[model samples]
Target: MASSPLGHPTRGTTGTNRLRRNDRWIAASAAFRTAADPLVIDLGFGASGVTAFELATRLTKVRADAEVIGFELDPARVATAQAQLDDVRAGRTNFSPDLRVSFAHGGFEVPLPAGRRPAAIRAMNVLRQYDEADVPDAWASMAARLSPGGMLFEGTCDEIGRIASWVDVSSAGEPERFTLSLRLAELERPGIIAERLPKALIHRNVPGERIHDLLTALDREWERAAPLSTFGATQRFLAAVTALKRLGWPVIGGRSRWRLGELTVPWDSVAPR
Candidate 1:
């Protein structure tokens, strides 16, 4: 058996539905549609596998044959997650037929007994503990574990399901897009996402940087779209993202996604300066 390379063990703070935003993003992703083996890795799934289980439930709608593998560095956490999954298997917990979730003790190496790489990997709130400079290496290591034409979603979110941001990385170990998903009710300004930006762009939220300009543009557009608040948070968000695009912000995705309080931008539009 090969040892995992992700040396440091995380704090293992697990919670329910904490990764809803990312899960939804994966469920709607094209990667799931064309995957030969629709397997997903819930990298660093913390102390419990509830988030992994939820991810399976959500993705099943897109790919009924999908499977979710939750990985943790701590042996104890892996044991706990496995126990929870077993309970679900034995009909101990309420689970859908398509929710095939499992647990494994692996670090950044993404240990697979059959040397099978996954179609998608979600590592949320995992790298925030490491130094900013370590991000690129970690991204490369994890991205290398992806199947051909696969995706790597690395990001952070608030404790609850609200504010979140992530980068969509390709199999080439390069980021293609930056995404921000937020709960828009009473939003002061879209720039608030700077605090939760992934390690790559978090520190680059300053003048002259692409991320800084992107945030500034978002805030400005958000203010202009305040009138859409009369319709609801969803309408306001749609209007704001649209405004950003009109101002050459390179915003991607459409109203259907923006309706969920989510927006994606090309990597070059917000990459570190």
Candidate 2:
């Protein structure tokens, strides 16, 4: 396998089900469902391999032959993940004996076996450490390794998975949409997602930016829908998103996803100015 160019070191902080929201989205994506190869890269899967293992388990439900490779730049972290893989292999974990998962030392370059390109690369919290200017190059590098019609889910989430957001990028490194997922019960305000925006938009949350306007409008509608709170947070969020759509904000997804506390919009609607 080819070696990746060195990139930033992550805090390596991860937890059980920390990326569960992301995994759910991936599992439901067309990239995962239609892939003939069904190979996925868990790029920079923190200090543990549980996320990779979980990814494999979830994807296999969609495609029985799904495969997952956890890539990390830190050799020590790769070794630690291997040890966890051993546990899965030894029947000491919840993973099936037939699980197809591995760990390797790599970075944003996404080193993979020759003649292989992944259908999806989930790089959760990987770029949070880099300067915002470095994101394009990092995105280009990873996007270069995707198969045709492949996708990149890149973003960040909190420690407990209560709040999460991601950008859906195509194989050409073009961002398609942005999505914010939250645990409605824990949500205080829709604007709070500004703190976890993808690197490309995180610093663009200031006034005058498109993202700023979007979030500002979201908060306004959310407050305006406060009467729906008597029904539940989910109803309030659904109402808020509907209000956004009515205001011509280019919101994507339907009440089905909104009821689950998710809101998606075209990338152009919030692209950094």
lDDT of 1 by residue, 1-273 (tens): 345457487786877888999999999887776899999999999988899999999998888899999988888898988888778877888776347788888877898878898999999999988889999889998999899999999999888868899999998899999999998787778788988999888889989998898888888888888888889877877888888888777778788888888889889888777
- The backbone clash count of each candidate, in order, is 0, 0
Model 2 misplaced regions, further than 4 Å: 1-4
Q: What is the C-alpha lDDT of each candidate?
A: 0.86, 0.90
* Model 2: per-residue Cα lDDT over 1-273, one tens digit each: 334445888897989999988998999899989998899999999999999999999989888999999999889999999998888899998789679999998888787767799999999999998899998888888888999999999999988888899999999999999999988995789898888888889999998999899989999999999999999899999999999999998888788889888899989998888
State the lDDT at 183 in candidate 2: 88
Each candidate structure's TM-score, on Cα atoms with residue i matched to residue i, is: 0.96, 0.97
Show the colliding residue pairs in model 2: none
Model 2 is weakest, by summed lDDT over 10 consecutive residues, at: 1-10
User: 227 in model 1: Cα distance from truth in Å?
Assistant: 2.3
Instruction: Give the clash total for candidate 2.
Output: 0
RMSD of each: 1.4, 1.3
lDDT of 1 at 175: 96
